[model samples]
Target: MVVKTLNGAKAVAEAVKNCQPDVVACYPITPSTHIAEEMNHYYANGDTKTFIAVESEFSAISALIGGAATGARTFTATSSQGLLLMHEALFNAAGMRLPIVMVVANRAVSAPLSIWNDEQDSMSQRDTGWIQLYCKNNQEAVDSVIQAFEIAETTLLPVMVCIDGHYLTHAVGQVNIPPQSEVQDVLPPFKPKIFLDPENPLSLGVYTNPSHYQEFREDLHNDLLQSKEKIIEIGKKFGKRFLRTYGLFEEYKLKDAEFVLVGLGSVMDNVKATVNELRNENQKVGALHLRCFRPFPSEELKKILSGKTIGVIERDLSLGAQPPLYTEIVEALQGTNTIVSSFFGGLGGRNLDRTAIKVLFQKIKSKKPLKEWIAQQKGDQK
Candidate 1:
């Protein structure tokens, strides 16, 4: 393993090369474009066999679907609107159980049209039947991409590795890129269970009537839920091999804390720093980072947040109702005494500083509903 200072996209590209995917489908978009760019460099050097540059995000994922269906390991990366553009193909890939791994440099979807960081793009497709794994930093982003292929190939389901755009994607950080020889032991060659073979032809994605349609959906849902076990198992194996631990969610100084903040992506760095400061001030505060967002980690989350005052910090909202992740937390802690609250910030890549996090904790302590904006604009609202 060699430790190198690299941006999140570059680190991920390195990991992808080490894993040696059979096919790479790339479409350019901000922040996420670097991942494809670096991978193209690998292709230029003859490190990768199949590198496809498609016209659009939709075409990119369509190519991935074909690659995966042909019994080849496939990968792609996109951000915000580009990801949304692949929405239709995303479901098709997951529904067909392609195990295509993708990286989403999480950015905001637009009506006002700003190409900035937010969770809205991926969160909007939370129910698309893809395994969503979020990273807090460049190192985690690289590791997540490596593990994603393992998890996706294991379960025969697609995986989406999400990293905060611009914040982590562009920021240079020290990352340990595992050697191809070492990574080979961790992630073996992809041997697909089924594929489009001419010799033994088989029909895939056949139309089903109302009678079998519901059953098919049920099986997909159940399979996804059961995949949680494999997720945990793979994480443990990775840790044993690499000395780096990962899980569905990571708890930070939560033991005996009365109030805790829950969030994902790069914002957790600020939350952790703020938690340490609050702890020094004799405050019982903690933070939880949701690494695995798709499975929701309900039982585990409920076990930890049973009686604490929970503050959910989200980069995306459901609009006119609860925020995306906050709603999931509320459902998870349904029968518990957890007083759940919401805190939204960092929209359109707005800076969410330590002051904002501290103020969020303060509001949680005072039992005051946190409805104030944490960005450049200050306001009071109900």
Candidate 2:
């Protein structure tokens, strides 16, 4: 293990290098650009070959698709509009069961055009048939990248390791870059069972008429749901080898709590801090930090949140409907007495501080289902 101070992007790049990807195709975008730059640096220094600098984000993912179709371990990174641009290829990669890993530096999508940290981008692709893993900090970002490859390869599904844009990507912190040998032990070379070879040629993403298209989608959906077990298994294996265990979601002091907060990504750090302070005051408040978003752990969440007052804070909205995370939680706890509420904050990189979290705790304690915005007031404490 090498202890080094690295920003999230560099840490992720280091992890990717250690994983020994066969090909990397990327288009640089804000917050995620540094990741692409770092990978390019590795390629320039002869540490890696087959780095493709593409014309656009679409081209970047297209290149990865081609590489993966040939049984190559592939990777890429993108953010905001760059990610949105790859929407078409995203489905292609997942539907074709390509085990490609990507790092999504989560940023807000445009109309107003912002380059800051938020979960809007990744959340928008929730149904794209890819596994989504959110990181809480830089070290977790590094560990998640290492685990993602194993999970993807084992399940034959693409995985997106999402980090809060500038919050993690640009923020420097101490990250342990596991030795290459250790990583290789956990994630051996990806030798896929199928590929585009002339000797054993077969169709991949061919035209499936209505008769077979629905069946293909159903199989992909069922496989994605079943992949959750592989996710948990790989996470445990990584933990045993590296001494850093992870799961579908992390429970922060939720065992005996009556009021709980739920969320994902970097904001959970603030959520945990506020929970600590409130606990000191004798408030039975806890936090649930969701690590895996896609495959939506509904049953696991229902078991944990069966009889508690829950407040869900999210950085993205579903427009005319309820917030995405809150909606999922509501559906998960549907017939229960869980009393889930929704709070939206940090949209387009707005700050979500401890003060806002405290306000949310107060609201959830009321036991009345509600929807509100956090930290929007000018008078709110920073």
- C-alpha RMSD values across all candidates: 2.4, 1.4
By summed lDDT, the worst window of 10 consecutive residues in model 1 runs over 373-382
> Which number leads on lDDT?
2
lDDT of 1 by residue, 182-253 (tens): 898789788887999999898777799998988878888888888888888888888998998888988999
Task: Give candidate 2 regions above 4 Å deviation.
Answer: 29-31, 377-382
All candidates' lDDT scores?
0.87, 0.90
Clashing pairs in 2: none
Q: Residues 190-261, candidate 2: write the lDDT tens digits.
A: 888899999997999999788889999999999998888988998899899989999999999999999999
